[model samples]
Target: MSTLFPALALTLFTPLFGGLVLGLVRPMRLAGWLNLAFCALSFGASLLLARDLLAAPGGVYTGHGLHIDAFNLPLIVLTSFVGLTTAIFSRRYMLEMYAHGRVTPLRMQVYHAMFQGFLLTMLVALGTDNLGILWVAVEGATLATVLLVSLYRTPESVEAAWKYFILCGVGIALALFGTVLVYFAAQQAIGDPEQGLTWSVLHAHADGMSAPVMAIAFVFLLVGYGTKVGLAPMHFWLPDAHSEGPTPVSAMLSGLLLNIALYAVVRFKMLADSALGQSATPQLAGHLMMGLGLLSFLVAALSLQRQRDIKRMFSYSSVEHMGLATFAFGIGGPLATFAALLHLLVHSLTKSAVFVTVGHAAHIAGSQRIERIRGLIRTQPAVGWALLLGVAAIAGFPPFGIFASEFLMLNATLQSWPWLAGLLLIGLAIAFAGLFRNLQPMVYGSAPEGQVAVRANLWPVVVHLLLVAWLGLAIPPLLAGWLQQATRLIAGGGF
Candidate 1:
């Protein structure tokens, strides 16, 4: 067996085992430690898999219904790493929630179990090669997160969870239709059910599939997955979920889930592109992506200025950033795709770090309201500065990875569709203003009387910010080459 087989199995099954074990482990403290341990083991295995893939010729690994290639290798590693850090952060954060009577022992049990399960689903979604399996994993993630979102059992939390389930449930249903359509096209082209549903096989035979069917399928797929991506008009559940869920759940939703959804969209795009390449409107799929992405970007940007809750504000920021990344991918070139990949990495780092900081901030002020959470610098310097820097990184400030990616994306836009470049710039500016307007007072304004510091785990935020800063200053040669390989995989060439 390939070394990749064991590493991938460990990376995936560790979480599965952890989730099952955690479900029955009633001691909240013990469960928390186990959750962290499981995430750490998964991250370690992912690193080993990354090393194995790098050493292997052609940077590809395939076995047991899963595929690892240049495109997903980085994402797999990223997902595991973020999951691990979020686990670390939550160990301290959730315990505090428990102490404060915000979470009961049983709820904590559910939270830890569902957290591991969520990671498992994300890993399965990223690692699988069968499109049908991908859909199931994503649906599993929805169920897991729905439980997480409603852990507080508050009226609003329950409402948010139900809203998330209904919206994403409908969205996933449409995605199922799209998946069936893809399978339909594949059957006509390849004539074998098993091989036809395999993504690699479909990609290999995409040109032989029906263009019209693929075109309609791409529409359903985009909207379906795009809803999860938090793209505009389909983003109603996002802010509520972020606001009502635990902060850690907010981090995963913003930093990770949206990317997985976008990853699904991109995979389908590859097949759609190949199928539509010879059609009369060759760029139909790309055009559709561009329109939705741009619309999401603009809408989220304007929406940000109106958010009163700090978490909701950042959630809209997630929408804006995801939109930008989507738009870059839609541009369809080496530079744009490279930027999109980088944006995904940096945004995940920055947003998760920001949420970690926000969690602490809310704890400090005893509220999530923007007006109530004042003078974080006075209350807790570490949390305050981390929030400031994280917001700066996410807002596309220089010397952060987000800025580098956005700059490249802008350059690509100017080259490909100059007219849309203005819109991108405007959206960026508006989002920046929206974030800082609320953020500045929170960081520097007067603290309320009797407000005191809370114990915070700043290590995750520190590590994530440093990584984002390092990537901005210079992409390490190894990662640069790896991203270039993924760029080639997605765009058919390297920059």
Candidate 2:
């Protein structure tokens, strides 16, 4: 009998299997049902993985060539949970598309299959022990999502897909070059080329590696992965892609995929800290990240004020939140790192919930333009309330997980760099203003004509929002402990 951790294998491959089956199936209805089942199974397995991760006193799970630690385990669970919720939301969302004659049955099957494949890529990215494998997985996700983004085959969608492909392809190439440099650095220390790219192996020898090469590699890796992270100057593709893609695709892009990419950056940053010493790498990376974060925060805040499309507005918000997460990690302390992880969780949940609600609103209102749609409360109260609450949570309103995480981040910054803290506060205030300025007209004004009631799947939105809200008020002691362990590992303690 082959004995292995069921959660790992199941999480990594179930979606691939499901995607294959969905592709082969004849009927669209069966494809949807199969996708739901596969996602549900994956989610259940992820919960089990989270349990196993929590139950392990040392927070380590090592089997075969794989290492499941506190850092990646929570990420895996988050990825799977988002995948499951998106799957559930897609059932009704896509069927609505079919009813509107926007897609054929065969096309729906393709979408379902591709959705699973996308999940598989994200899972593989989060679970891999090798840095090179993680890069490949992220690139694979980029390709899969390009297809999903262009599923509608409209001129705008195709353009968005092309932009996504070009930008990400360039980014992946740079990342590969950086990966090669890292391998070379590791080879000098460990004297084995093959083992050089393994994360655990590299971490073991990081301190012994050449500092200059590692520094150069870190720059390449940051710029490359930063594109995927949606940091400024490299974020041109995000808005178009999110605005034109299927709503579920947009949700996953913002909620799960960006976090996985940032995780890769954090992993490398950990390695860099080990290689170059903590003070050197942390300060260098922190300054650059904070600069980029400030730029993204301000740009997105102002951009939000000009957004005519509702989803595009949120896409800018995604860029801003990604910036905030990057800045938190850049600060590189126990408190900031813990806040980064918490921010990732809350942002993923809240953004996905918001997008699901946005999809429902778009469906009922028959438009994506913010100016054309008004008075969501009068039209579709469920989606209206969900959007309002989601925006509030994402904007760092009181009693929300985002608020708690942001507050923690600010406190950390204030202790170390009070000037940076002030800058962060100003950026946050700007964002709050822009978000509310756009949100008021969309949610509280007069309802426009052509609005029809949609059979919205409010369950996923409700579940995600509730979780985000709960995390704000109270974090489970166990989860907090796991985050603390992960934070310590990133800080310097060997996992």
lDDT of each: 0.93, 0.87
Model 2 lDDT tens row, 240-278? 998899999999999999999899999998888777774
TM-score of each: 0.99, 0.97
Tens digits of lDDT, candidate 1, 325-364: 8988998899999999999999999999999999999999
lDDT at position 422, candidate 2: 78
Off by over 4 Å in 1: none
* Clashing pairs in model 1, backbone N/Cα/C closer than 3 A: none
lDDT of 2: 0.87
Q: Which candidate number has the best TM-score? A: 1
Counting only residues 3 or more apart in sequence or on different chains, how many pairs clash (N, Cα, C under 3 Å) in candidate 2?
0
